[model samples]
Target: MRTCYTGEVNTQHLGQTVTLFGWVHRRRDHGGVIFIDLRDRAGLAQIVVNPENAEVFATAERIRNEFCLRVTGVVQARPEGTANSDLASGAVEIVCQELEILNASVTPPFQLDDDNLSETTRLTHRVLDLRRPQMQNNLMLRYRVAMEVRKYLDSMGFIDIETPMLTKSTPEGARDYLVPSRVNPGEFFALPQSPQLFKQMLMVAGFDRYYQITKCFRDEDLRADRQPEFTQIDCEMSFMDEFQIRDIFENMVRHVFSTVQKVELPQPFPVMSWTEAMQRFGSDKPDMRVKLEFTDVADLMREVSFKVFSGPANDPSCRVVALRVPAGGEMPRSEIDAYTKFVGIYGAKGLAYIKVNDVTNIPEGLQSPIVKNIDNDALRAVMERTGAQNGDLIFFGADKTQVVNDAIGALRIKIGHSEHGRKHGLVEAGWKPLWVVDFPMFEYDEETKRYYAAHHPFTSPKDGHEDFLETDPAKVQAKAYDMVLNGWEMGGGSVRIHRADVQSKVFSALNINAEEAREKFGFLLDALQYGAPPHGGIAFGLDRMITMMAGADSIRDVIAFPKTQRAQCLLTHAPSGVDEKQLKELHIRLRPQEAKPA
Candidate 1:
């Protein structure tokens, strides 16, 4: 129906007659002559319909924004001084020979160019929302990123493979979305949280290298970067160590950034151990773009009269650290109180600080309520340890280890991106990619009083650490590594437990008994009894990667149709109740709602 896209008409096609199909992006009646910007997926081109062509002009007069059209025109250079240098088709205009309104649209709910449109309204009118130029560009960028990943992985001899969506559910850290089976009454299939198990099975079945751009699900609470359903670049390999796996995937990411974004990431991205990451920055995924770090002040505070500092300092399970903010002595009292409130959200009892008004004068020059409680010598040690100079502010986090880390770590990032950090030029420019490795094999949940897999159950313990699996799981480290870009963990993987015995030992440490293991992962256990090669793999969050690439705030912006934080599809109104007959077939019964107490 069309010879070329609207945006494809340029100076090179001048004088050539072309048939373009698109929506009327904008229509302006300049006195008698009508002008329309015809837009397609490629972009937009201006179409001129003069009254001399009476029939086409009449059709153009009835055209409105978003009206689908077919324009047959002769391409010509746009008039001098009227050219739009911003557009690819800027230098040319299409002189309409024929204009056909394929479909008319009602006045759109909101203009596509309106930046302040609410998410709810945009989601409700998603078709129109996607018509916006930025949306088009984001989706196109997503496509190109996926293609680039596929091309790079294929070149490295990785086979593109498929994994089942509805499969047996094993705990992979989150609740699964279950599907009821009509054929088998009371039985359900869980959506794959990841292709974790299936990919490992592929390795045991002797597929040397495998990859999939596959969907993953997690029936957990949602956030800006999270979705009930998301995509991951799932990969697995046989006989490769952590180093080999990291090297291949790192290069792949670097290749993606270079080819897609035209920006070269560092040749060898920096590495930080998981322990170091948490201790220094209070997060597994540390944002290296921030210049702040934690400074230990426990020893100095041990003998101090202030019980708030002395109490946590004396306990091995607790930490007392200071974050030295350069030139932050001028921060107003209100701002410090606001930050104290922010830290309170993470379970911090309070935020303490000592403003270094003069490094030369100790107790006299320091400014803080707690300074008088702490001795001058101890204060000097605290300042010296943190390298606190004059006009700097030393913020302290004193609590149980986790709370201290969480509160101060978050404060670091917040301050780095805050008005003060920007005003003082603390946040660095450009990308900061790094590898966080040597993660603890398990984290002991105090409430549950049992160890949980730090990564996943299949992850292998570091060399000779298998003995500690049952004895001291806390001491064991995993052969796992995560690829982090800035502060986001782009991908994570580890060496798999190939032997059946080792796999059983890991399950035992997680407190899964033999009978339960047999029930939940019987197939995997049986497969492991046969010959299984040494293997490891990684799954990169495709949405998160594209989100960073496109500079979008949320993963939903990159997705065509995404659920809200409540996980509802506004466009389709999904998750509506099913008919009784359909529920009967699945042998499901709806429970009556209980009355709420007043």
Candidate 2:
């Protein structure tokens, strides 16, 4: 018999007989009648079995929760005053003429409808957990998002191309998860952190446009937004600069928002330079939902008697900045102390504040334990610059410029959510998309005392900046752009260096000696010499983008079988020990644990 999805049934099909197959969500008995809520991926349908059909009623009586069953039933309208408004087929019920149990499940560890189960427990039985409506919806949304991405890209003449997952490793980024080589005995193959190199090669190979929804693996510490293996909607195109690539991707994103959420984003997302973003908000990715902004107070602090402010202000590398929280003057001393401790996490020694009770009266209204030692003019200058009005509090961070930015930047986000109560609702409803361009080619790593590529080695320096490659690498800007939505970095890409000489120079500047560079990226360098094109591409974290669009806290919600925080598959218990024979076949020896002497 042909089967129909339970959720597809509606009142329009009343009096029509249909075969429905699903799991029994719940069973309710009322003397002569048994009602079963049959659930399939489509939705739920209430099935009624009358005692008059003694055989079917007997079969229904033995049915329990999660019992897989197929039932032939006639759809009929519910009795007067018995309709359920919560369900799509609420006004109708199915009368079962025949019942057959396809499979029976033992009682689940927890009820499928239970919302209180811990994530660990749910992950342990992911198949059962996925049966829940929420999980089903999440996966369905993910499918729709992926489809939308493919449709959008394809319409724009982008080709969906597949890249090799088993690719060689490159230096200068996160650690790679290596696969044991069976034939090579001891040598190993590394999983691609991204399809970065291959995609660039495709551009050089004259594939004008290429895209892939592929898996990438990175052996790194896990966070809410990270996994050992993840998917990216990788795209690359030839003869395109950073602006063109950014525009295409932004349009694609806007298309997804319009099609999926039915919400229209602004036409042009506001743009901010890297230096501007850092100076104003102390972060590259500043959440615009918050109105609070940082103001430089270094000049004002230069003459202040407070050494905490003067010490940092006097040093060239140090910075002193203040952030004003409006209507925050009433914040208790304990709360201020708490914020002080919070900034310490980012390397700030302490937090200083001036609570402005009244803006007009400077001396009496401005209250700060340390302000008494400062000149009134200096205090007024800070208040005026930060726009500190009545009932506002100005918090200051002083230290090395990096520390000040990190501490203040994180505090701004924390205060926006907790104190200001700004992070509310889904979608933030504002389509703030922008192309953050002209990024520095490299960042100086203090610990290593060397400069590393800010994006990657392949990124080409801006037109005029190429001359400064050896003499002043710091002044060079790359042809790179990051696509930002609201505050999140959706994706980033850059025009690559097509010439072999420039590529080698970038390697040299990154301190990758000739021998090491040849060893790690000889293939790429070789490929560059073979009639390469001026090409650039961008990659969007498909899971992250979808998760944000789906209004989920983490990308794991949208992924069907995501790994846990420790990068272990809970349902299948992956990353478990393998049999000795399997290891031997791979020509590997297990590392013995050290024995403790008694």
Candidate 3:
């Protein structure tokens, strides 16, 4: 309820009279004169009640932090010594002609600028927490990003279409959050994990292109970047192959990055196969910004005396790789121990390392406890392969292929952060984006003894790889691709399987027989028979994408009202018990919950 935003009034509006309504961000009293910082979402403006204005002065004196007020004042240049160059409204201050306190407030539970408060306490007072400038800026950036997404897609002839939020339960790789039905008692509807099937159906319905920014829910555990409910920028197209699909979306993201974040991502991001990514960086989502990469010493280690190196070297399913950390020879023993412990979380049994102390001679440069366990030939090979140098340290992970990759990959990222990209919660000046392509169509789940789709069941197997679906499922690669930025996967999609026979073969490879496949995805199978066009599209996690763009530590910082890692909303107290009458209306029965001891 004001003439203009606080930030909108600057030197250009000097001497103009205006009315502002906002909370008191900060209040200061210098002798009899009072100064208060009036804050709205746009930003903070300085207001001063001169001593001569007795009525306004008295009211300003009574105002405390966070007190809602309406002020009518004439904007004027601030005193030379009082100017704040850091703020948009810094050069001027409002000379209060009148001041009215619309509402009074007690002190906030925590200071807006203080960093010591726990996340729980901050979440409990989310309304106030969001008032902090950082949160406000994050949400504003999120808004701009979303709008830019719309602008880009619209310009590209993408029509915005909505899909059902309450749909039938389907296998979507995550447990669905079910809604009990009222009219159809004993039945349930599941919240859409994604509009995956609906979007495909849109393509089948002859909608050339479609896009939606919609909510998706999953009854899954949470993490720094995950939530019980999240937003996705879902899109689909018809008659476009994987190349055309990737080009359109890559340009869309580039446009958004240029428009929203003001960063121009490099065109035609370097592409690498999933196999190559795993081999070099030990992760399908590699942060190439990091100078670190692994060297395969498996061949040389096959005959070494060190069992830790030689044992895994001979196993076809295991790998012996080394990471050469620059200037790592200076790391104290305790740091190495801590690093060893860090890799342990990813299933690595132990960490093996060799410190390079001298560059003049290979044998003399090596200085590690296990130097005696490895032959000179093996040591020289590792040094040559990884390009080790004096003052560098080589860390080794020899285990099952996945475990080795996961552990070393994680270490590589951690080191990159500890050295660059960001420190604490602040990001630096550069970014790296890449396209990781050619992913395996299916992955063998050793625990379940079954193959699961790598990207999804709908992803089409490559032309020549279709035969391998039946003969060698492990070797079949899908025309799938992911857009990764600064180590986070911004989005992913693939050419979809439109042929029923190919779909059935994929289902069979995943061990889902004809009957089970029909039962779960009968509608999709039915639609394919009626003629579905060749199509592929991508879905981006808006939360994660915005988080990376904002350089935020977690997606929660970008989400308006996020739950804790336990998936409980502190602000709304969601997941609360329903009344007995309500449950009866939904035809539900109550079960006793086990009590936990304090």
Q: Name the top TM-score candidate.
A: 1
Candidate 2 lDDT over 488-550, as tens digits, reads 878888888998778878888989888988898888777778899889888888888877777
Q: Write the per-residue lDDT of candidate 1 for residues 222-253, one digit (tens) a residue.
A: 99999999999999999899999999999999
lDDT of each: 0.92, 0.85, 0.88
By TM-score, the better pick of 1 and 3 is 1
How high a TM-score does candidate 1 get? 0.98
Q: Which one wins on lDDT?
A: 1
Cα lDDT of model 3 by residue, 290-387, tens digit? 87788888999888888988899999999989988877777789888988999999999989888998755667678888888888877787888888
Of candidate 2, the 10-residue stretch with the lowest lDDT total is 420-429
Candidate 2, residue 31: how far the Cα is off, in Å:
4.5
Model 3: residue 538 alpha-carbon error in angstroms: 0.3
Report the error of model 3 at residue 439, Å.
0.3
- Candidate with better lDDT, 1 vs 3: 1
Q: Candidate 3, 201: how far from true, in Å?
A: 0.2
